[model samples]
Target: MSLVNLEAVHKRFGEFEVLSNINLSVSEGEIVAIIGRSGSGKSTLLRCINGLEPVQQGRITVDGTEVTAANADLNNLRQRVGMVFQSYNLFPHLSVERNVTLALKVVRKTPYAEARDIAHEVITKVGLADKFGAYPDELSGGQQQRVAIARSLAMGPKVMLFDEITSALDPELVGEVLRVLEALAADGMTMLLVTHEMKFAKTVGNRTVFMHEGRIHEEGDSRETLEHPRTPELTGFLDAVLH
Candidate 1:
């Protein structure tokens, strides 16, 4: 069975359909990227996976737990899934280490000392060991985003969802966040990133999914789908972006 699965998922807000018959699966240790133009439901799909938004129809299963079901333990499910947003979302008043440790201490019930240790380890992994004591306002945009990534990693999630994490960063700063993600990918972390960075989507992901309007228009191996897009929508998108 796939590590992550979404079968015929549908989400609607009032009369507007945000997602339609979306079906996708991600295997363990796979790095998959979802790409599309604006309003393609890319971020909404991630939100559904994390339970931030409820699906009106279909099933979404992560590991073995059903996400779209009402009776499911959402807290337990979220502990196994981590999400990083386009904005850093770090607390300006909290130090980097404190921001990373808050969830561990509050939700996981880990002791202060243990949470601090875990925070230290993840901060170092994200290459911000020295800035652990610094507040979010004191760090560069890229560094702050890395700290946010570390904060999510500290929770020990099985799958990570990145929702256009680089879209808000300066061009030069985007590389730093992408570098951290690349390392995680190299370590075989199961990840799904919603992004418009076509080059990285083509080169780094194990598979690439093209979402158009409110559904997946096409999907396949990264190289094949990006190089030889099968549909007019995908081909036009690639041409508009690459050329």
Candidate 2:
């Protein structure tokens, strides 16, 4: 069964529609990369799925739970859905360990020792085992992004949503964060990401979705869809981005 499913979803800002009649399904462990222009609704789509944005129409479900239900527990839904953003939203004064454990300790009321252990495991998973004691400012942008990823991982979410997480990094540092995603992909973590990294999307994505003017313009196997785009819009987009 699909873990994430959206049917005829719609979202708008005043008269401007951000998402339009969207339908999508993602199975367990699948990696889907959403690529489009700035206003194409990629980020909004993720937000809607995670309940960060409210949709005007359609149903959304994650792991058989109806996210669109009137009384849906958004806070509880968020526990199953982890999101990482363009900015590493770590607390500057907190060590990586503390930053990762904060939600566990405060929100979930996990014991400090238990939270610390979870933090250690996820930090190590992101290859930051040696930097747990470091503060955010002390680490490189890439390392901080990794910490952000580790923090989300520590939540033990069923799915992860990444909103251009590497966009804020220096070009040279982008690879490190992408590598962490690659590792996560290898470990069968279901992920959906909005990204401008064409190569990474093709490499790590099982499917690639091209959105244009709040609609899915094209979607197919990552490598084939990216390499042999069937639509003028996708072709133009690839041409613009690649060259």
Candidate 3:
């Protein structure tokens, strides 16, 4: 079975449908990149997969558990599915180490020393080992975002969801965050990223999904899908983004 699965998913906000008949599957260690224009439901779909947003119809399963089920263990699901957003969302008052250790101590009830060790390990993984003592304000936008990613990694999630994670970074700093993601991909992390970085999506992603108007308009091998888009919508999108 796929590590993450969505079947005929439908979601709406009040009367406006944001997702329609969406079906997708992500296998273990696969990196799938989701691409689309604003309002195309990319972020919404990511939210639904992690159970941050409830779907009105269809099912979502992660690691063999149905996320849409009434009795779903959302806490457990969240522990296994980590999500990082465009915004860093780090705690300004806390040091980077504390920020990463907070959830481990609180939600997971890990002891302080162990949590600290975990934080150090993940911080190192994100290339921020020396910044552990720094506060959010002391770091650059890219560094703060890496801290956020480290915080999620400390949870040891099975799958990571990235919703335009580099969107908020400056052009010069964007490469740093993307490098961290590339490292994670190289380590065989299962990831689904909604990204505007066409180059990364094409090269690093195993599969690329093009969403259009709340639907999966096209999907295929990442290089093929980006280099030779099968649909006009995808072709136009590639043209607009690539050129």
Report lDDT (CA) for all predictions.
0.93, 0.94, 0.96
Candidate 2: deviation at residue 195, Å? 0.7
**Model 1 stretches astray by more than 4 angstroms:** none
lDDT of 1 by residue, 1-243 (tens): 799999999999898899999999999999899999899898999999978999999999998999988898889898899889899899888999999999999999999999999999999999999998999999988998899999999999999999999999999999989999999999889999998888899778999999998999999999999999899999998888777
Question: Which candidate's TM-score is highest?
Answer: 3
Regions of model 2 farther than 4 Å from truth = none
Worst 10 residues of 3 by lDDT: 234-243
Rank order (by TM-score, best first): 3, 1, 2
Candidate 3: residue 134 Cα off by (Å): 1.0
Of 2 and 3, the candidate ahead on TM-score is 3
Model 3 bad stretches (over 4 Å) = none
lDDT, candidate 2, 86-171, per-residue tens: 99888998999999999898889999999999999999999999999999999999999999999989889999999999999999
Deviation of model 1 at 164, angstroms: 0.3
How many backbone overlaps does candidate 3 show? 0
lDDT of 1: 0.93
For the record, the alpha-carbon RMSD of candidate 3 to the native fold, in angstroms, is 0.7
Order the candidate numbers by lDDT, best to worst.
3, 2, 1
Candidate 1 TM-score versus the reference: 0.98
